[model samples]
Target: MNAPALRLALADDQALVRSGIRALLAGFPQLEVILEAGDGDELLAALAGTSVDVVLSDIRMPGLDGFGLVRALRARGDATPVVLLTTFDEDDLPLRAAEAGAQGFLLKDASPEDLYEAITRVAAGDTLLAPVPTDPVRARYAYRDTSAPTDTFSERQVAILRLLAGGYSNKEIARAVHLSEGTVKNYVSEILDKLGTRDRTRAVLKAITLRII
Candidate 1:
């Protein structure tokens, strides 16, 4: 069977890195290079009128940054999946991206095979991938000392979190649960707070570790 066709965008501050990724991804007959962006703002601008299937971006860009771009996309209710390439695994970038509604995360030094596979999975709506760390990304909730949660989340929040862990978007979850987007957002906020995580994705991961999800 033919590989599924994908209209993809790329964002990286380094022209060299962008070129390298473009070259690697070129081997995938199903993936077309729709556009290249040097920064997050540029990426958003490119997305304004373009119909894209996926975005592979560097986490740290000159303007706006990858996290901000993902957040903006969520704010606009766009579901074009995003995949971030990061140099630091210990920076909380991946977890933050997920909280902001990204599709997946990959390390900058990942093998071409891994990169290709990640794109395929992201397009398929999966988020539970092995943490591909380049330099030990930081945990949103440091489990260094076996600390426990001080507050428990309600059943609704727990349900929201389980779906989040499964990589479903807030809008999707809202529609599934018959709740307004605002209410879902509030539940996410409370979940993060109760889980002692700075972002929802981190909270989800932490919840998994503690068997809370």
Candidate 2:
């Protein structure tokens, strides 16, 4: 079947791995890689006006690293899709990626077809992580004690906060809750505001603490 075209970028620390990924992607004409980076810093440097539909990046890299770079990008309000291509979907990485607003977290050994599909799915605004409550990856996200008092988030903020905890993309939550994607984004912003949290996982932890979700 013909797949939708995707403008792509690859970031990894290893040269051979980058070349191999490029070679594999070359087999699929629908996937066009516009640029490549050896590390997170390079990825950041290469992003402006690169016109990428999706970014495939490693979980761990030198300098800015995967999670940090993804967090930075999302923080700057870049809606461009990002998928982590890693050797192992380390427990923390998935949750961290979710919290960082990454569109997808996928295993590196995933077939090229799966990789290609992930790029398409994320670019289309879908969550790539499997759905199952209490999954091991979710458990890996540590919930530490907070001595501070709980903040009172409104009902809408709490609702979006729970979906964020469940690793739902903004697009997914918008569909489920009968709101627009931009509105969901605003709800997430309110969640961050009322809970005094910086990112998704922190919001999750705060919700857990406050018994809001």
Candidate 3:
């Protein structure tokens, strides 16, 4: 038998954008948008009664933005996977969203395939950070580029860094990469040192600025 469609809730202040997304998802038979809200608070309230497999939300909603929403849900022990959407101008918000317990992050203008992939992966208990367009990110923080190292990350480091951007903890990263937690911690420290950042958020931002992830 076929699997049931993945039920989804969407939160965005703009009705048109929500409608457009709803329309786009309508084309995917395996996905369903069961609820729509104008902001995080509204979505949270609706979620109190409605069950959904995933949430696709705008990062800059009017009330209780995506980061706040993720924190609130985590505080309430709601583990429902959430994908926070951002526009090109707001490229830095993805790291914050991930740190706040969001399971996925994607550009608002992401292709339908990317959105679909994020929702599916997050729904399946995996974290994801979609490929960000480097041009806008580079343009936003061009000043920092000169300081960024010319050295490239190994394939393994890049994978771990992507998970870091998805907000995975050391333990989670270890499990994902089949390494010990201590090893993951070491890798994280190395990544921070290479990026010259003191924390995961800054490391991720620097990676984006340098077009490394």
Candidate 4:
């Protein structure tokens, strides 16, 4: 039997952008755009009555933009996976998105294949670390004067950091790295401390922003 279609919600201030995305997603029958909204407030209002497997939202809406949307969802203990989209690929944006509880981040110009992969992965409960552009100036601006030693991660820590970037949980990371789950947890905590972050998402994004992983 075929799998059921993945229901989706889209929120963007621009009607044309929402329509364009809805139209693009039309090519994939398994991915359905079940609801659409103009901003985070509208989306939240609809979400009170709607159920969706994933939310694909523009980062900048007129009200309660994408970061706020994710934060709101998390605050309500809603675990629905959210993928944030933006035209600007600033180094700090992905970090901010991660910190806000977004499961994935993508550039608006990303190809259909990329979009499909992002939606599917996040729907499967995986966080995604977007590729960071190489810009030393911007990198310095984003992570300057941090207490974390940028160049001090050991090889083992680096390997674990890479797996964290791939959104592996403690159990998955333990299996991949041949460590106990407890050990993985310890390593993750150390990684966060080394990166000056309070959570796994921020740790991974900060590592990427600093070119540490």
Q: Whose TM-score is greatest here?
A: 3
The local lDDT score (0 to 100) that residue 94 gets in candidate 3 is: 52
What are the lDDT figures for the candidates, one per model?
A: 0.74, 0.73, 0.79, 0.79
For TM-score, candidate 1 versus 2, the one ahead is 1
Clashes of each: 5, 0, 0, 0
Candidate 4 regions exceeding 4 Å error are 131-213
- Cα lDDT tens digits, model 2, 1-213, are 776678898999999999999998999888889889999878877896576899889888888888887877877777788888788744555556666777677777767776776777678766654312232433465356454434566555655665676677888777656689999998888777766678888878755654454
Runs with alpha carbons beyond 4 Å of true place in candidate 1: 1-4, 128-213
lDDT of 3 by residue, 60-161 (tens): 878798888889989999999999887754544555665687877788776786688778878977666444434655566443533765366665686678
Candidates 2 and 4 compared: the better one by lDDT is 4
Q: What is the TM-score of each candidate against the true structure?
A: 0.61, 0.60, 0.67, 0.65
Candidate 2 stretches greater than 4 Å from native: 1-4, 130-213
Candidate 2 lowest-lDDT run of ten: 129-138
1-213 per-residue lDDT for model 1 (tens digits): 886689899999999999999999989888888899899999898899997888888888887988888888888888888888887856445446656677677777777766887787677665522233221222444344345776976656765775676566778767655689989888888888777888866786677667564
Which pairs clash in model 2?
none
